[model samples]
Target: MSILLKASDLKTPMSASDLFSRTGPLVFEVGFGDGRYLEHLASANPEWNLVGAEVSLGSVWRAYRRMNRSGIREVRLFKGNARFLVRDVFEEGSLDRVFVNFPDPWPRKKHLKNRLLQVPFFQILSSRLKPGGSLFLTTDHPEYFEFSVQQGQESLCFDVIQGPPPPATLETKYARKWRDQQKPIFHAEFRCHTVIPSAPRPISSIEMQHATLKGSLENVGPFTKQVRRFEGGHAFVMEAYRELDSQGLLFKVISEEQDFRQELLIQAWPKKDGVYVSLQPFGDPMTTKGVREAVLAVTDWLVSQGLELDQTWV
Candidate 1:
């Protein structure tokens, strides 16, 4: 059911506050890194309500902890990307300020498309902002800084702010790391026009990730492998890192006899890592042979890749 947008309660919140209560306008911080800047901003401006959005559970927990530790109680935190959630839930003209600081640069040319400051995103943001609301942004990478400034300058309603957002009492992990690396920081601000351009694309189904994993799974894994509980998930999952050598191989498989929910993620920890294996989120479980063949096909492929028969060490 495509329920229309509404602010303050985007998805379920760890902490919820009436974002705009006529008492004070709300401020939103997208990609609120480690929640440090979020706490600083909220504490500094106690009158303006703050809403922090992040995709990582760790960051969400850190933000919650920061709020508790600082004894600051006037903020809301959400755990998801701001793209889809923002449009569907954030009410128009409800925000006074929105901050984006040092998002992933996605350095590869193909990956540059992954940036947040796209035509579609700016369109959605324009609608979310109050008439004169400001969007603040900062970046440490010179290329990204320039890209953001250019993107903001060309955006439909945005006018690149000449100066940086106000300094805060803290720096996020990346901010601190960049500072240590002695990288220069760039800053900019933008405001949407009275009537901004409409969004270029509609909201997409959640099946994107499911499809991504599906495409990768068919071509991933060691032909022969064994299952092991994943690190944080405590179940088979995808993650970073490479293998040491071609001594052994690991395989993770999951079968849930329930609905078509994306409840599984398989991975391999080969003594030798080639390309990272991406596994299907859901596999057909109506027949035992179907499951076994799916498993063996992946394993046989790995065996063909020269994996040691005795991979039990993995």
Candidate 2:
């Protein structure tokens, strides 16, 4: 199998045992840039199964190439938010160690929310890690290091310890740059003291959603933007486009919830009887309430244009 894995390759709340061919210790690295460290880990511990998550497509490609060149087979890489993998996937207590090296500090006060090391994330990590599992983080930013330590403590799930980073960490690309610049490197180990309850907050319970309307698609033009607010989240229909080849319209929508956001497309195509409105599965969108609301927002917008709601499935 290819070392690189798409989001659809694994299910929500996936099992570590299912990821690897043989059972072994599970090591995860978040933001694995260039895949050097993960390569080192896999080489050094041949029995260990390594799983990495990276959001940057360039980084993922580079890592995949490096792994392929090294003939590494025990590593699986995911391209997406690490928070989603840790919180929604990776069965409870399946992780043995999580490495975070030189992650973006998001130094600006206004951008603090974008920083990955937050209290809620720590809590999620606590629940995912085994009894002795720990989060090892290394960074050159003093403010971010302190912020991470404080967040770990605030989660009340770990006993934080300041210490020297592993020797392998200094060999990474960013680590070498920081060392060359004579920047101070800080390392910490957030040892798990408590395992929070295993709760996977899935986006939605249903797999798919759709609606049928009793209206004509004729003159359903000049689509206006719409927004729908529901409990815990909101959906915004930013823009709509008409498909020239067929009598269909595509609406670009964004759905937002705490710590999760998705951009999706809702499609409205004419049927033999009426109009059909459903979420397009282009991005493998999770059917969250916000997403459902997005479909409703599009339907309501059509309703405003004189479409009657005949049947509902959302």
Candidate 3:
């Protein structure tokens, strides 16, 4: 099984043409809520690349599993906001088709800024879309649909139209609701006419880490035993595993490098007692020395805290 690394980890990327090497043209859908429409499209168009962006963890997990089981090899799914992937991972003119379907309306006057059809969003679409690439947008809310159209025209990258696109996409949950209520599912197809604009460059490392960590913390949980990737991978998860008791406050570290092998490295770091430190080396034996050095560097910087550190325990 492929390891689902933290959001901060590396991802496999390819050139715009190579992105759809195994598949066909890369068709991307952002804010793919309840994903029934994505299912219909990917299943129907097996030759095309199907990329989905979903903010909900359960939604992403479900959609990925469903598409994989459907034998849709061209699909790639991300469990994060659309902005992070578009502004960071994708290059200019990388996508063939972009979809924004029934995003959060943010109806309150104070909350309207949170809607997905803001000015910067149109700019991003302009950068990602190919020279004749089409962006398909749909919303049940008339106000948001008009707002999106206004923003697109103001950006001067898209000429908006109301109705079906060249090749119509499928229907989702919100669209079904609109149909039942006799409410029109407002639609538009925007064609990129000229050179795409460049985004404000990628953020700095500090800003980048802050962005990725926000997504990673969504799946954090309590664990004592090591959580390996697919029961055979190197990545280990240690969560809430270092609580110190007043009595026997020994820290145990466990690692799994490969299948059928588990190594346990126990480091007994006790304050007001050098016996435990003498029994075992002060270093965190489970990790490499380089990681050990990093731990020491961080711990050594905390000397000013009210909590005192022993001469040798980390």
Q: Candidate 1 or 2, higher lDDT? A: 2
On residues 95-120, what C-alpha lDDT tens digit does candidate 3 reach at each position? 88888887788888999877766667
- lDDT tens string, model 2, 56-161? 8899999999999999999999887888788877888889999999999999999999999999899888888988799999999999999999999999999999
Model 2: CA > 4 A from native: 288-290
What is the alpha-carbon RMSD of candidate 3 to the true structure? 11.6
TM-score each candidate: 0.58, 0.88, 0.63
Alpha carbon lDDT of each predicted model: 0.55, 0.87, 0.54
Clashes by residue pair, model 2 = none
User: Which portions of model 3 miss their true places by more than 4 Å?
Assistant: 1-23, 165-170, 199-241, 244-314
164-190 per-residue lDDT for model 1 (tens digits): 545662177777888798877777777
User: Candidate 3: global Cα-lDDT?
Assistant: 0.54
The clash count for each model shown is 7, 0, 0
Candidate 1: worst 10 consecutive residues by lDDT?
207-216
Q: How displaced is residue 256 in candidate 2, in Å?
A: 3.3
Residue 141 in model 3: lDDT: 80
